[model samples]
Target: MPAKRKLKLVITLIGLLVLGGGWLIVSAQNHPSSQPAQQTQAKSKPKYRTLTLDELHHDPTLTYCSIIYYTVKHGKIQRWQEVSKVSLGWQIEQYPTNDGFKVLVWPDMNIKKEAKQLQPNWFALTKNDSVTYHSFIIHSFRDDMTATTNLKTIVDQINHDHAAMKVRQMTPKMLIVKHKNSAN
Candidate 1:
């Protein structure tokens, strides 16, 4: 039994040495510092931005947050597709929410598509006095954003566009737009 054990240990050591030698050869051939051989060989990347939905909120002059709820038509409620709502947690990331999900936040609500609760008129907001934000029509934007903006950019843009919007806001659904300052 001891002889058999010794023979097995020897075989294992030999196997390990062979593997190590093979790895060293391969490592030399494929050096860690090797750069791309040609510019054409480089892979093109997917389209996306470094900014996350959270960073959009920190804009001091923020407008409002837009939460996009994705619906998958998969049968059997099989996660009905992956819903992406930027709720305030418990991001199992599946949706059809009732657990109270909050995806977007903004100082102003600018949406392209028509929404039921949205009101186009500017809020004469007062604390303790119900300034009911009945949803607003979400305007369409590029594919990059669910809506036109996350929140801060919307507010900043709104601040920039407020003057023009005042004239337009004479009627409902007319967005509050501010014209660019001449100095700028």
Candidate 2:
């Protein structure tokens, strides 16, 4: 081969090698193996369990509150908002007798911390009434009567367990009660 042709061939081969090396470097950076240990672990472990209806109904120790009313348009039951415990109290007081589907929720305990972590907000509108809450569940009833009935049933059941239990309606839709025994 001519010397000029040989030089051209060498230069082309070098260019191809450089391009191939650059592509490999870029791909390695994007590979899952390239991710930090913490990120890989986080992706594998979920921060919270998805709330389910069965878990909510069966777990009485779980602190939760409900808003009883009938609404013309029903919203997604899974949705949640951030609010102070006090603010929730105020909302209950303000709309004691609204008519719509009943709304029940197990609010998140630390809204700020949960928000910072970028987790889904499932906290109820109320404050943390008990330390036992790990996650929250929210449900909406079809009508006011059904909600009221369920609320009464729940209150009665709680009272049955403790004779000294005093249940008070904070709002037409909200109830706040505590067992007389602190140990309970």
Candidate 3:
């Protein structure tokens, strides 16, 4: 009888230990410790980067610009289409108001002559290709705007210009609607 009693006590103790071990495992999974959770969140974070307007304007490598032109009423429906892209020069200056750009352009002699004939006001002091010439298009925006937003405003002004025909005779204003540098 005593042996039987000892055996029952040992069995009950083993059963209790097994249940306690299982409960500990489940509790650990359901309620993770605060330190590890916070550590994991801290280890994984996000970063954002953007270019400033000044930096973008001064970039020499950004020498090319796509252009598009449109007329309000050429005695009929307004004819609009993309035109030849132009290459810019190293000289770039900010307007006195700090709201626009004066970029130097070295157009091919033929194009330059044609442009000179089209809009004499666009010509700077230099008429020949040896020196820098500024045929600037004005752009203005809030100081806090991003570079992309500034570019969008420039494009909008180019497209919406009522005197585009008078300025360049539909030689495509100084902005683009859709143009990809890639051939593909």
Question: What's each prediction's TM-score?
Answer: 0.18, 0.25, 0.27
Model 3 C-alpha RMSD vs. true structure (Å) is 15.8
Q: What lDDT is reached at residue 3 by model 2? A: 100
Top candidate, metric TM-score: 3
Model 3 is weakest, by summed lDDT over 10 consecutive residues, at 120-129
Return the lDDT, model 2, position 13.
100
User: Pairing residues by index, what is the TM-score of model 1?
Assistant: 0.18
Best by lDDT: 2
lDDT of 1 at 101: 21
Task: Write one digit per residue (lDDT tens) for candidate 2, span 120-176.
Answer: 222222222211111233353332221112333333344443421121232332333
User: Which stretches in model 3 have alpha-carbon errors above 4 Å?
Assistant: 42-135, 139-184
| Predicted candidate 1 versus true structure: per-residue lDDT over 1-184, tens digit per residue | 6999999999999999999999988987778455455532444543322333244334211111112111111112222122222222111111112222222222223433433243222221122212112123346432211122223333333334342233123223222333232210
TM-score of 2: 0.25
Tell me the whole-model lDDT of each prediction, alpha carbons only.
0.31, 0.34, 0.31
